[model samples]
Target: MIKVVAAVIRRGQKILICRRPEGKNLAGYWEFAGGKVEEGESKRQALVRECREELGITLSVGAEIFRAVHDYPQYSVDISFFDCTICEGQPVAKEHSRIEWVGADELKDYQFCPADGDLIEILSRGQSGI
Candidate 1:
C-alpha cells in the first residue's frame, strides 16, 4: 500500500487544491496538496516535507481531517488529509499543473482522484467536520 498525506489549506471559504502534472498518474485531476509518506518518517513529517517540496511553503500541520483507503488496479493507497496553515511562503505550482483556492461548493467542478471521492463529498456537504 502507498501511504500518502494531503493538506487542506483552508482559508475562509476556500481550500487549496492542486492538479497533477501531465504524464503522472491521475494527471489533470484535482487533489489536495501533499505527497507520498516516506519510510522512517511520521505522516506529519512527510506532510511538512511535501508541502515544502511541492508548494514551496512552510506548514504548521493541524488536526487530521479525513482518511481513506482506496484501491487502484496497479496499487492501493492510504491517504490522510489534514487541516494546515501556511507558516511562510505562498503556494506555487512547482510540481503541479496548477493550483487553485476553491470553495467547497465548487469542488465538484474539478475532476479529483478516486482516493479523494469521500472527502470531496464531505466538503461539498459542509466542511464543519474538517
Candidate 2:
C-alpha cells in the first residue's frame, strides 16, 4: 500500500480543503491538503513538506485525528489524517485547481475521493473538531 498523509488544517470554524486539478488522478475530488509520504520521511515530515509544496505554507502538524485504508482500481492507500495549523505564509493554490475553507457541515456538499469517505463523515459529524 502507498502511504499518504493528509492535514485537517482548521481556522476558527473553517477547514482547508483542496480540489484535485484536471489531468491528475481523481481530478475534481475535494481532499485535505497533503500528499504521499516519501521514503525515509516520517508522517509529520511528509505532512509539512506536502503543505509547503502544494499550498505554499509552512505547517505545524498535530496529532493524528483519523486513519483509513482504501483500495481503488489502480492502487491502494493508507492515509493518516492529522490536525494541523499554519505556522507561516498564506495558502496558495500551487498544486490544486482550487482551495476552499469550509465548515464541517459543508463537507457533504462537495464530492470527495473514495478514500476520504470515512474521514469526511467523521469531520462532517463533528466527532473530532477536525
lDDT per residue for candidate 1 within 13-116, as digits (tens), equals 88999999999998999999998998899999999999999999999999999999999999999999999989999999999999999899999889999999
lDDT score of residue 115 within candidate 1: 96
* lDDT tens per residue, model 2, 4-71: 99999988899999999999999999999999999999999999999999999999888998899999
TM-score of 1: 0.97
Worst 10-residue stretch by lDDT in candidate 1? Answer: 121-130
How does candidate 2 score on lDDT? 0.94
Residue 102's lDDT within candidate 2 is 98
lDDT for each candidate structure? 0.93, 0.94
